[model samples]
Target: MQAAEWRESIRNKKILVLGLAKTGVSVVKHLQALGAIVTVNDFKPLDENKEAQSLIDENNARVVAGSHPVSLLDEDFAFMVKNPGIPYTNPMVVRALEIGLPVYTDVELADKMTDATIIGITGSNGKTTTTSLVGEMLSHASNLEGQSFVGGNIGIPSLDIASQASEADRLILELSSFQLMGASEFKPHIAAITNIYGAHLDYHGSMEEYISAKWRITANQTSEDYLILNADQKSVFGERQTNATIVPFSSTSQQIDGAWYDQATEKFMWHEEVVLDRRDLLLPGNHNVENMLVTMAVGKLLGVSNEDIKAGLAQFHGVKHRLQFVAEIDGRRFYNDSKATNNDATITALDSFMGPNDRVVWLAGGLDRGNTIDELGAHMDKVHAMVLSGESAEKFQALGQAKGITAIAKAEWIEDAVQKALDLSNEGDIILLSPASASWDQYPNFENRGDRYIKAIEALANPDSL
Candidate 1:
């Protein structure tokens, strides 16, 4: 459908809002503000509804809680404003599309509302960290008028922020697969696809479809835009289908043209002129070093000075939920890495901090994405014991059994997993939650999973015993 036709059809029309989550609530508010009759739908009961009620009552949108049936949809509604978490292949969504109901996403709405320069970051992993770092770096370098806020897949509603963000001369956006699917014309001045690995396989159906979604960051880029990529990841840098000037960064080699790693001082050498020291990066990881290189290359492309880049790198405190330290007790360090939902991320988390002799009780498992956990075989020797939970618990147990290692893989819940981990942990040991699977099986998202893990660890490690 043409953009104008799509817009007019939804203009002041009845709309069905699916998934009353953060993004869903924001979409309801935006659509209602434009005088559309909105009805919020979810799989839970509406009675005593807390978050949904506040958003619905304020916007005068009706709430149909407790299961999503096609009957809940009013024929008068022109389109379905889908939450990114909901699959495009969902029976309800597919049926809606079949009936000529236009399915629009939050990104599509945000794209229509903003006129500011956008920098969207997408990948199978590292989107949140990279987006946050980019925003921080821009803040240090940019003397431009207006404000800059980072949001999209990371957190917050960019459209809502854009409407109120006067000081935002630029917006740093973290786009996800669902957000990118309906982004339509969402392009960024500086776009990067950090890395692609097997992820959200259930939602994507195939690896090819998943890769296509990540590339959506560069979907609408013109000749004037910058497309920075992880030179280490062939899934991104090796793609010859793109039109933007391919700037690459890698920790492995300095052979890439634009940004390459210096093995001596561990600095990111760019254009044979600028260098950003890896030591200056606050986030401690070889993965983060790669993340920093990508951001600095983008900064260099924008003519951001060395001092500003350094200042930005220093000020960046690192993203929460990715190896975020919760607390330590009895000399045991507990880390909440609920964000490590893929194989690469979990492996990076283990390699970043685990010591050779440290009794590492690794908490893993969740819905199996058909990912090859064999990739984690190298770190398997590093980890002392594995505590498995969620759908893939047995698979992990089998892996440990086959390898003849110590592991506990019977947890039905996060707390069970924590207790199992604690039972296996000793003084000077580290407890890490680096589940290599999506969190949707047991929690709202990875943040919820991480928060629960941190809370459970806090209860286990009582310092008042001091």
Candidate 2:
């Protein structure tokens, strides 16, 4: 639908905005501006909902903030706009579904409100780095300068940028499984899945449900659209069924058609043409090389020159909290991979920096999401010591003991974990904070956990400063 038509359809319609999170606020503001009769609902009490109260005052919209009253559902509402974080099991959402009212996320609303070409990216890992790279590559391309907007799960909400985009613009979005779950008509012109692994099973309930949510990225895509995937990931390639043109990228195999990392030559190749040397990339690790391949494939499809792609990949560093270098103290290097919220992600982090003589003082453990750490057993030989914390610390200690890791210590907090890792590390050793679980047991999110880790490291480096 065109932007004007979407605006016309929402004028004066009774729309219910569920949850007053960041995305929820954006939805209420956008709908109100379009002449929709908006009613906001959130579980937080009115005294604690300053944002919702402000929105009500500014937009003149009705709000039921104290609780999710079922009486609100009795009103003849046209449809519901749900926050991505609000689960499908929410009582109000369940009621809305039973009544046959259409439920949507801000992502779907953004899709209907814009005519720009969309590039949707989703995966268990590497979504942020790939999304940021795509944004930078498009920015450097002389043809695409001032014509690309990158946002979604990476930070800025897509709904806030959709109205400002023109038909010639490119919307680069990093979509999460939660946002994708409520998406019905969000068909991106170019969609890609970095890779899928067992993650968010606590919310998704099963591995099958988690995989299905990721596949929704290409559900509405047609043959004219493009779907970039990791050819090395059997779970992604073997299970994918889509009408979109499949563009496979790999760091392991060269038999694929779209893009491949030629390990023999250490070059990134697209259709047998070498685009850039592996040594030129600023980002480290084989996983990052795979991310570059995905970005290069998208650039190639958009007619971006090989030179431009090489330049973008060379200049781009990486996103924070994913194998980020903290600081070197007393000959020991500290790296933060706090974004490793699952076993698969931690495995990738471990693979990134393990050598014959190197020793890693690994810090891990958090909200156990029911995924096993058996995969890390094969790589345990590289670890010098294990420092565990959070709710799953004891479980991790037992797992380490079973793998024959001799030096293991358990801490009650992240600060203590950092100190424990420091005590166990020797000169020339590496201390890595790659928690293979969620941080909800302590910090609100992974970013907060990573920031706390950085702060603790700084304090440890200067003991007398405090």
Candidate 3:
């Protein structure tokens, strides 16, 4: 759609901006600029909401704060632009859908406004890392015709970034299933599903629903577009759902048609050609190796040279909160992996430190989502001890007992958890905070949870401040 045509379509039309977060605020400003009559609706009270108050005071925009009353639909809105985090099961969203009003996340709006070639990435895990990898790779490439922009679920709201993007730019987005569920016509030139696992069951209701939402990244793509998938996922091969040409990546086999790790040569291979040496990568784990395979596929698909890809990979240590190394107090090395919000991520983190001498004092637990600890049992052999916390603490304690782990401690808060972990640990043991659950029980997001762990580590390092 032409930018002029898309803008004019919403002109003079009443649009509802649901949930006044960063994405909601950006959508409201863009809608207002497009001459649309925007009504910003948020569940936060008007006095408590700074974003809503700012819109009302500065731009004189219409807003309904405090509650998502179904009566808001009486305004005859053209469509509803919802915050990605707001589930469709939400009362207001359900009502909006029942009324046959079109609903979308900011992605759809961003896609309509920008002419940039969108490269969207989504999966159960590694979305942020792969998105950053592709973004970094493209940024280093001299062959690219224009600049690259990274946003979406990776912090920056896509609307403003899309608005600033020129036709020559590459918009690399790290999309969450929550965001993807609401995306309708948000097709990307290059769409990638890093891998799929059972996640967000509370929000999605079922594993099937969650996978369907993740696959929506390619809903509008045709044969012309590229869809990079994990070849390691045998189920994905059986469930081919996209028209886009599939580019598969794997950590197990080097013969994949897309990208793979050549064990014999000890190199990262794109199709058949080498991209980067495996030993050169500083990031730990086979999961990161899988991440690199996906990243290289994207870089190669964008016509980026192997040298440029290597340069980008070389510069990247790792993203914060994902297996980030903290201070080594005495002989105990602390690693913050507070971003592992699911069982699979925690499993990966546990498996990564399986050295004969590298015993793990695993710090875990957070918001309980009714997860069974059975799957985690197999990966706990290397975990010499466990420090549990949050809503899932008791559940994890059972796992600790079942596994016959020597040391199992529970703490009320993250700081206490860190101290408990330290108490359980001996010299040379790795203290890891790889909570296999979300942080919503005690913290707003994973970053906050990770930050708390880091702060606690600092406290342990400098006892004088205490």
Which residue segments of model 1 deviate by more than 4 Å? 1-13, 48-51, 65-78, 99-101, 235-240, 325-346, 353-466
Tell me the spans in candidate 3 whose CA falls farther than 4 Å from its real position: 90-100, 236-240, 325-335, 338-347, 355-466
Looking at candidate 3, the ten consecutive residues that score lowest on lDDT are: 232-241
lDDT of all predictions, in order shown?
Answer: 0.76, 0.87, 0.87
lDDT of 2: 0.87
For 1-466, candidate 3 gives per-residue lDDT tens digits of 7766787898999999899788888889888988999888899999989999999998899888898889989878889998988999899899988989989998888899888899999998788988888887888999989789999999889987898888899899989989899667889999989888788999999888888888899999999999998888967546647899989888888487889998777799877787889767656677788778888988989888889999998777578899877877989988889989999788889998875677899999999999686898998888889999999999998888998986888899999999998999899898999999999999999999999898999999998888
Worst 10 residues of 1 by lDDT: 1-10
| Pairs in clash, predicted candidate 3 | none
Q: Go through the candidates in order and give the C-alpha RMSD of each one to the true structure.
A: 6.6, 4.9, 4.9
Question: What would the TM-score be for candidate 1 when compared with the true structure?
Answer: 0.71
Off by over 4 Å in 2: 234-240, 325-335, 338-347, 355-466
Ranking by lDDT: 3, 2, 1
Model 2 residue 314 CA deviation in Å = 2.1
